[model samples]
Target: MIAKSPLRVLVAPNAFKGTFSAFEVASAMAAGVRRALPEAQITCLPLADGGDGFRATLVAAGGGRTSRHRASGPLLEPVWARVGWLPGRSGETAVIELASVAGLARIARPSPHTAATASTRGLGELIRAGLRGGPAEILVGIGGSASTDGGAGLARALGYRLLRADGCEIPEGGLGLRQLHRIESDRVDRRLAGVRVLAASDVTNRLLGRRGAAAVYGPQKGADRATVAGLEAGLHRLAEVAGRDLGTSGLEARPGAGAAGGTGFGLLAFCGARLFPGADLVANACGLDGALAQADLVLTGEGRFDRETVPKHCAIVSIAQRAAPNGPGSPGAL
Candidate 1:
């Protein structure tokens, strides 16, 4: 039976991968929902949980602006990465997504051995630049990275030194591990400590193992079978060094440890950041709960709804359902 009332509907959706942006998905869904309930008050909120489309999705959902920041790219080029700032009461917060700077998308075919050196150094520069303006908060989205250097490149850019046991500096990129040594973080930027760092990710793979970053994502980055094995071994050694130097263990199995290669572990270990679902952060920004409170119906969609799309991918369905009214004549769920 068709139910009629002065109903409120909320439409929030994530990206459908390479096809549509979250904003576009939400808009399309909202159109369909409005067609179903012509008189319903519909609120379209596009969301992202720190994946490839995080910045663009958030900028579209909220009144935000995108700016270009020069950063190190997957190939070590000085590339201009897209960063966004969402308007807030305590001034605007800069959304710096590592994917924008060091994402797998940026990696091209005919990749270079230097590609072996691809690092998150550019992401760190973008973060530092965002803070140069003294923004309220720095929200870092870590996902889709092309490098697997344990975020050593990022640490170096932030003023930490990756030194060999002989005190020589380590080169940038994952292959730099061939010159493995100790780590020196005494010179890391103190300003970073004063600001809040929030890491948004969905991966839970550790830093090293059969389930580690290299073994799982190496092929995606164009690593050959032998290269993968080498990277796996290197990561194990790196983790051991980290544990010995930092005096902490369990980084190898920490949820999101495999995010952006190994930057997830690096950020948690060094930056003192709290890791949360990319969807949760996006939900809070878009006020999904508040919209749901007023919503009688909900509609949503995503790029792919499959096994690989865990934690973050399910957010669309989950949030939409949670926001829908639970009554006999309440809105229909889709």
Candidate 2:
């Protein structure tokens, strides 16, 4: 009889929301795998969907380092934010996750007033800091944001003057959008012109209308009906101005444009950034495909695994299915 080779196992998991992080989950799963297969070769790849844990996950996977900077929070308060750095052969890459600064989690309590006043200016500040490092690429994970200002605050942070009809700067947050009229990009940071900006998001909503950021996500952030309506109008005005001043028209209808309270739209319009699937971007950065190619068995999970877990859209499930013995590469079993 032929002897079988020891199993090569890969354990990759997403965070169990409201519980452990992806790194912690990966560690716990690795321990369980060790107990079950004492002699198996195990590999762990922690995963994220471009939200709260994105920076940590990528940094851990790439042996990158992190630096903290004081930035504005969702409520315009001072907060310490961390940016991940990954050195490459050519130049370094910076990973900036919006959750670190503008996430809803930063809010102690959700209220209509807080939702209306939340701003993504801090996220823009983080990006500006990252740019100072002279990175070749900036990977912005726009999820878990608390603002609906259409990236107006971000533009302001990067030196774009979002002025009112009277030529004065608007206030911060969604309410500020009401006064937004024109954008002056002449003062935008020159560094942005040389760096490639990529926005990671799974959202497909547009920047306006029913499926827009304010309409779909504002209520979740504590916005009332009236607040949502107001935010919607504000975002519409912002989009019109962005189109006219920045020549970035039709961005409001783009997929992922509504993510992070329309910060995605802001990034696209003002920074000339491109959008990508969060999972795919994270997976590639972690080299999951290479690991899958060598695995004989793969185990993947998240906090909740349900029928919504499909091979196409679900990150963990997709990784597992792709590593299956009958899957594309046909190398592993899951």
Candidate 3:
């Protein structure tokens, strides 16, 4: 019954969380497959859900290059972050992951104070650097963020001024939103006018309410009950100001608006970026369907694979189903 010559095997897996990158996981799986079937033809396609390892996964799959820059961190400290680039017919396409610069991983020990003061200014600086390359499209992965600033700090870094009632600039982070303010966007980077921006996220929480960023993710970030309540109030105030001053109404209720501590709302409001599911965006960019077409046997895994491993909206599960033996035109079709 063992009549097979060479099996076309596809190995795709998410990162092992804090232990290994997606690339490393794929490589390890590929190696194991090679050991079992020396003649098997294996294709490695690492995947991510837009939390971390997003940039590396995309770059590896797309054959892109990585560039590093020193930018502001969650605590306004300096950190070296990476941006991915892939050259195309139209121009270069840039991939930026918020976790690279503004993620909670940057904080050694997260506390209520750290959560209260974390900022997204570094993310804006990174975007500016990406724009300097004259990219046709910018793909931003907004997840694993430490701050809940409603993107005010990011907007300010990109030239939008957040002025208080007294005409003074507010401090950084969610705490600053307590001051009633107006937004000025005349100074926003002109390069972004023609560039297309796409934000990839995994969550679909709105900007305010029980499922909002502050309520859903605040405790994990070290925000106490009172702090979470303050953040919710601040975000509500920010929504009002942004709606009035910048005309970005209705974003507060938009899905994924609360992602990355409301950086999703900021991108939609300030940069006009459209949000998409991170797994789907990454799958399309990596040409997963095309790879599956040629796969005789498809393999997918993560550090922990459980009932919750593949959510209803996860593209990875869809890919696996499409490549199943019972699926149409699969290599194992009878």
Regions of model 3 farther than 4 Å from truth: 303-315, 321-334
Error of 3 at 208 (Å): 1.4
Whole-model lDDT values for every prediction: 0.75, 0.86, 0.85
Candidate 2's clash total is: 0
Query: What TM-score, computed on C-alpha atoms, does each candidate reach?
Result: 0.85, 0.91, 0.91
Model 2, residue 242: C-alpha shift (Å): 0.9
Evaluate residue 16 in candidate 3 and report its C-alpha lDDT on the 0 to 100 scale. Answer: 74
Better of 1 and 2 by lDDT: 2
> How does candidate 1 score on lDDT?
0.75
After superposing candidate 2 on the true structure, give the runs of residues whose Cα lies further than 4 Å from its correct spot.
Answer: 304-314, 324-334
**What is the per-residue lDDT of model 1 for residues 1-334, given as tens digits with 9 covering 90 to 100?**
9866677777777777556777778778877767887887878877776777788877766889988877888777889887788898888888888877888777766253534677888888887787776777778888778888877777777887877778988777777776777877789888887777778885767787787888888877877777777677666766777778876577767878777778887787666667777777778777877777776766776766766664442466557445444556545556
Superposed on all Cα atoms, the candidates' RMSDs to the truth, in angstroms, are 3.3, 2.5, 2.8
> Candidate 2 lDDT, tens digit per residue, 186-291?
9999999999999998567789999789988999899999999999989988988888988998999998899889998999998899998788888888898898
